[model samples]
Target: MSKLTQLFKKAQSNYDNYLKRDNVDGLEETIKAFEKISQSELNATLKKATLTELQNCNEVLFLIAKSYTAYAFAKQKELSYTDAVDSLTKANQCYQDITNYIAKIPPFSLPLDLGRQNTEAEFYKHKMKFEQAKMEQFFIKHKMTGAYDAEKAYEALQNIATAYSTFQRVLEKSYKYISYKIDFGINDELTNSIKDELSEARTLLAQAKNKKSKRRADETPTSKKNDNGNTQKKRRLRQRVIIEEESEQIESLSSINHSKEEEDTYEIPASEQEKRQATSESLPTAMELSQSQPVPLQGLDLLSTLAMSFFAPPQNVSSPLPRMSSTLENSITAQPQLENTNVFWNQNSTHIKDSQECNRLLNEWSLIYFNSLSTPVSEKDNQALTLERLGHALLLAAARLQKESQFFGQQKINPALRIAVQLLSRSAELSTKHFNPELTMKELSAQYAPLLKAFANPGRQLYNLEYLQHLRRQVYKESLLINTREASVTDIVTASFKALANTCFGKDYEIVRDTCFEALLSATYALSKNNHI
Candidate 1:
């Protein structure tokens, strides 16, 4: 081969080698070498070459841009924020040049490879914008409270919002081309990431606005005391101003939700809204109640109240009672009231044990993890980790139930088991829906299998296993049919209950039915407590 051809071939081999390495420092050194070559022999060769030669030069630029973008991502993963931002800026400029160069070539004359390069360039351009926005967000987060500048923070947030908007627009425009060329769903990832960033930016903007409003309100003049001081009048005026400020704060929060509602109205279809409403209605009222209340009601007290409401007969008799009948009625009522009051007092005297506190903490963390899954930017790895932790929580809860079963009978263990199953099944369904490997689903299922066996009858283990597999298959199929749209927690819980009802339980079928009903009630209560619905 000629010296010129040999040089090009060596450069291509080196580029391919650098692309495979994971070390950012090595990649940086390779980039420097390429730049030196590009400035000397490559520049001279490019100046004298034809259209075909210019296309080859553009290919070289494409490789360089890709390397720079990869290095930027590595730096980001390392949390070297400033260096990552600088790398991304340079990468973006390189991609922009590639985009402009390809646009100048006639459509009829443009090679297929050039079209692919152009799509890649557009992808990196938007990708870099997203990275830059993230860097700004990181900077804002690390700023010290004492040194924080409200104006600077607001400006950073605004820039991030703008970046998200522009990145979204670019992705939407180029998605089809990129999808065809890349043979993967770039559009979905870009859309979800940008949507999350935009939501965060808007939230920060609202907070900033609220802070500014509060400051202004605090600075407003209050009435001064006169020489013949009417202190009462001044106090009343101050109270009225405080009330007005509180009302304004409420109005601001309502306005934010109102705007979100309007946006949701356009995006959410009628069918989806109906599904959501049905799920919300089915969720337990206790969950909503708990969200409002400072402390959760004791499990025993809640169960007692539910039992009384469900089992108490109506008393419609209004006849005047004989002395003996009245005395008997008073004695019966007083006895249960006295017993219940004494039980409540006794229960109050005992402190919560370490095990119970640990259990409570586990449940709280599991709920938080579940809530985090709702965020658009949540990753598959994070989701898997959360699910694994939930599995551990389930095991801990099962152990507690097993201990309780020794004292309270198997029937008493039913409610806790049902909740654990619902949580496990939902996590499994999510793992599948998000395209997690079958191994992840299998590992989660394996973790919960022992608990499932502990709850199921010996003769019904096969049936329970079949039902679980079927539920997972159905969830996966439905997710695929719906393009992997997320199912609500209510829907997941309801489906799990339905599965439990349908599964064969041998001689314990009646117990299973009771368990399902209790689970439904408890789920509704939990949902209500959290105001999740």
Candidate 2:
């Protein structure tokens, strides 16, 4: 006999011993034997083994034995009702092993009754019970080989018939339950009911199949209907169209819910908007509130504080130390605030002072903005464009703010000469930092180079050193990292010429900057030569 056949026969013997003694003595020994056998290697002949063969193999027998551990625990006399529950638990483990192996096959379809708790232990218990029921039913309905006792087989089949019937009915009931998703809110109870029904069905099926057939000896055919109204009636098979349609609907609903909740921000009502603003205005301004209990100020309020500190120092302060502390703090705070305020100063005096300071800064930043524009930047890579644009915008803002400052302070600074000088120096520095072809370390040597000297025009000077070179360098470094090509000599020359062409020497005199115009013409010629190569 094949190893699978031998394994089944051995299991049968062990089971018979258990029925006679109601103990695990023989079963344990059989299990050990099966475990050993499963570990033994078989040739390629086993590759052709069918599902039946695999079920009857030593491997399955070993699993069945392992599954009985829970039952063994339950069997102890000292154990309570909880201990007796071990039988189902052990059976569950075996069922899981069987299911896991079965699921690996391609295009596998688990039986409808097999939809138990989906846990390995529960799955194994259900699977083993079903398989055992199937095997018993098959044997009972069919006769065994030589040495089979017809009397015992018939007796066992009759004993298991009711159990098999009950299991089948339960299985059918569960099939109906899942067929229509009956949801009364308590999913757990519904699920448990289904599992219990399936388990019962499997047990009944196994018992019914265990009986040996005596049909050949008896000349007459037995009636299909049983005495207890539990007849083996034919069942109608269900079609897949309804289930497929329901599944599609569930999927569509899930997709719609996801799309609805995906936005980064949501809108607020106008009433809520008014309430939030009212709450904000109730808070004290930074100046009104003392340092120890400083009122809540937003991040950009620092720039406003700095500008106010510069214009209106508290008239009562005596010591130089406190004045220095307050000034430093105000400057630091004002840096962030400048970007927050698009419109600055309401009164004429404050506006004039702020505007004068801003204009001086604007002149210097203007020079930086024009110069950076002329520099060759990569048009190929997308990242390069973003950095270039960011640099361009920052410089433009710097110029606008500076212009506003100078316009505000024009009346106070008299012909704004002091602000004018400050503006001219920083504008030169910005030009050298961004537009100068050579990043020379020489101590202001050749500081009066055409581009730097061009910033000296009384009409176009910028005062804010803080606004001058820092942002230009930041943008330039970022551009370099993003660009594929390095800023070459020819690129520098072209950029310088472009900067000169765009700059205003004065409102009325363009001829004063003839050297720059000549340089542009030369750079154009140089570019033509490089293209031919």
Clashes of each: 17, 54
Question: Model 1, 201-308: lDDT tens per residue?
Answer: 777766655555566456544433243443456877767756766776676676567546534532211110000011122122213333332222222223223222
For every model shown, what is its TM-score relative to the native structure? 0.37, 0.20
Q: Score each candidate by Cα lDDT.
A: 0.43, 0.30
Residue runs of model 2 more than 4 Å from their true location after superposition: 1-5, 37-48, 58-74, 77-93, 108-533
> Could you give candidate 2's per-residue lDDT for residues 1-533 as a string of tens digits?
46434544345444433443454655555544444433224322244455434333324333344425422432333322222223333344343443444444332343221221122222223233333433333333333433444444433333233233333332333323321121111134434644564454345333323322223324232332323342343332122434555665676566556435422111111110000111121122111222222112211122123222222233343221100000101111111111112133233323333224333333333334334455653432222222222222222322333344433223222112222222232223233342211122112214323222222323323333222222222122111111112332223223322222232223211221232223333443454455441
Query: Candidate 1 versus the native: TM-score?
Result: 0.37
- Give me the candidate number with maximum TM-score: 1
